[model samples]
Target: MHDQNFTSLPDLHGVPVFYPHGTQLIWISSNGEITRPSRETLAAEFALGVVLLCHRRWSAARAAIDIDHYLDVMELFAFVRPARFVLPTPSGLAQQLGLARPQQGEDMAALLPQIAFILLDELASTPDPARTEAGRIATMMTAGGWKWGPYILAHLGLPQPLAGPPDSRYAAIWDRLADYTDYTPQAEPGTQPILPDAARQRLAEMLGENAELRLPQADYAAAVAASFDRPDAGPNPAMVLAEAGTGTGKTLGYLAPATLWAEKNGETVWISTYTRTLQHQIANELTRLYPEAEAHESKVVIRKGRENYLCLLNLEEALAQMPGRPRQAAALGLMVRWAGATRDGDLTGASFPAWLMDLFGRSQTNGPCRPARRMYSCSLPAL
Candidate 1:
């Protein structure tokens, strides 16, 4: 994950600019002297990632983050950073700098803060001078904190601008704020307060007969009128090696218990199967069973590598370069159709041919189905 370009630059201002996964640093001085940190010192500081050189240095390091964490960090870095245009070096930038960019599976530094306070502050309190109020509000909503923002705005009596034609929703509010040219919010539907346990009772009634209707389940359901009654029982962390033959309900046995465990602990459960067929089957079965098991509700999401998803950039490039190519046209057509249907961008369906799957795997930076990043090797859980 260390970059060669990072090896070329002398550290500027006693600060070695490093990305989350990038480790190499070049030292620069006021006297124009460039010196590499000693290998011994680097080893002491960063065992695998440390390197020493005359003018540039490259180092290797080990990380303990898992693939999920790595992806989350990437997301945080990309859209959640407080400072606009502070994005990390993109793949294209790395290429321009002649540095080897870390692979998609690389770990993200754990210590880096990922949340942006500007978005939060604007959503909760006031607008930022740098960002448009609309942009700040939209970003906060997309980042999943809109609920609180709207509620707070309502309580504060701040007027949000109505958008679009004057004949539209904000016609009245616009009349009031038109002179000021400030945005005004259209009135949102008022909510009526329900009985405290109404939702829980409804959920319980919905899951009435399901065996998974334990306290946690009942508490979640609206029909079952009850207080917290379930004891703390969850899966113990362990490395399990099992070899079960056909006719064994291995799929159900694992899925059922693991789904309940996930619900109880509020943790994600990752399931990996050896064969593509098994992957599809397990995902489909889990999806089906989730609705039936009302108390222990779970959502099943199948995630594959990015290549499996329609690569808009690559597709655009292909189309622009080969407008008349029959193969390209056909590929584009198929991608369009698949984009509408595929869930989680997994291009594995009965209609999708095996050859196409192979082609996608080869042509795209499609990562492994399961996150097999080195940092996650030790953290993978057993079914």
Candidate 2:
């Protein structure tokens, strides 16, 4: 299959074909004619057991392609689906795997050999642990025999059957972090006082070799450091209104002192962002302070509203309706896989692809359950 050259639509009748742009499905006929099939014809062909392959399933579905039969190569490999901004086309996958991308305007049919080789290579190279997990999830969703199961088994080899239904007990683990009783408050001032030079030095250290000491950034850090001075404030609170133009390193400037103060005082410092994008940016910037992945997970946290995370109850409800909803079941199955591997329960800005919600017709992260709401009501201390 990897060495075969495809010249016509009949050659790819039952074979997986790569289509990068998802807005429309194109076919190259035997006479070298490009044709776009109607959604009805596409559905009929799928109903008659025609198999199509694509990078992202959601894109094909949007183009009226049947979601039940088509194989999503990206989801098959990634396990955790990638964001939409990252294209999962043959070229995109090749680039990610450090292989050469298909040339521009290259024949789509001729690219079949390369695509087959890429998929086979990726499957062969996948770690056993990941393949096992992916197979288990796929088996659970397909129930050992469904439309996509045979294809997966024939092409990629069958994975182990699921041990049983996934344990829902693991779902509430996020709620356990809200135990404020375990938190101990800091009563006295920290032993090490935060000064402008010290904060600037910390910032420099955090930036490493990329550190470009800006005078304004140091001054900003100095101003923010003064906020910790109880003696200076006396009976009132100290407020610093800083105004800086774009491109000034204000985030690192303030973070230096804030992190230092938190560490020395053994306190939690809450840094709020107006937008989710900025929140993610701040989280990314913390990598400089905590370079190790596990240490960063333990140190810095991104807390959002209850609506941003998944509700286990809602997921159970969605799963219960899986009878006539193959698409919904597939989406939920993917989410279940993601839940197991997610760093936090956050479904919005994390690795959980936004397109999955679109597949199921609604966002899973909205409308928290009562228990989830109550859990979010309590104060969560930083780890």
Candidate 3:
């Protein structure tokens, strides 16, 4: 996580940049001269990230920041310094640079920063007014009392915008910026019948071009049909246990009938699965079965576990307690990026490291985190 997100990274005790994971820097002069530091060390990398995103304040404190997206800083930093480099890897620098992972013992960490220096030096602009920001930013680094003050003060300078408009998001900072929703829970179970045969026929028709009904799937569909046909349509719903193995097309087997039944009866069926991933998978299939018009009306919706979301309240508390906690720092970096990008707040398909899970588990709750009080309250209503 790298793109300039953490002016929030606690300005620790007059030390402008103190990163946990390894980070290194390459100092470039206004005249485009390059100075190589010890690329083997983490000391320069984190500081480099700080200087890259440092907002000039004619004073020590940075300009007031507006955090609009979930870890915009992480994206920024990643763009400059991919975490895959600093973090230990068997492939090392070669892999991080998209080169073939070599078997030789060349120190990748040592080499990467130097290579990075070469690239930046080549790209560095001529010493001129456009680079005034870079010079001012390099000055800010020296003003922070870094051990490498003389080097940064001499070499680095230029406040060029790292990204164009495509990479930036304004901090409109919506609190309850959720979908406009108005729904009422049904008071009783819907016992009315939807034509199972009609739904079954529809499924067959839709898949007719490429798919044919398998014997096991057809049998499963027939059993579903029998359950609905039961004479004893009482308040106590009938239970149907099914057994099918892989390649059985069981999803379609049950979906064909269930779609018909729900359509016929105008009822919502709660489909449960062992994992949230599977839950979304089923929801996607339901969408394919139904048209967009009906799908939006609760015909298919994913009801995830409480943990699968970004909690702003928890995030604030965590940031407050972030000093001296490196794992939380790393996890927060990932969370910040996730917050900005994910649409439904679903953690599905996201890669969560152990630290992130530890952090998320601390904030997760079965119900609303708290009774609705403020915008950042525990409850995040799904739309």
| TM-score of each model, paired residue for residue | 0.30, 0.70, 0.48
Q: Which candidate ranks first by TM-score, i.e. highest?
A: 2
The residue pairs in collision within model 2 are none
lDDT by candidate, in order shown: 0.33, 0.57, 0.41
Error of 1 at 81 (Å): 40
Model 1, 224: alpha-carbon shift in Å?
29
lDDT of 1: 0.33
**1 or 3, greater by TM-score:** 3
Query: Which of the two, 2 or 3, has more lDDT?
Result: 2
Root-mean-square deviation of every model: 24.4, 7.1, 12.4
User: Candidate 1: RMSD over Cα atoms?
Assistant: 24.4
Output the TM-score of candidate 3: 0.48
Best by lDDT: 2
lDDT of 2 by residue, 114-143 (tens): 555565455446687666655555555654
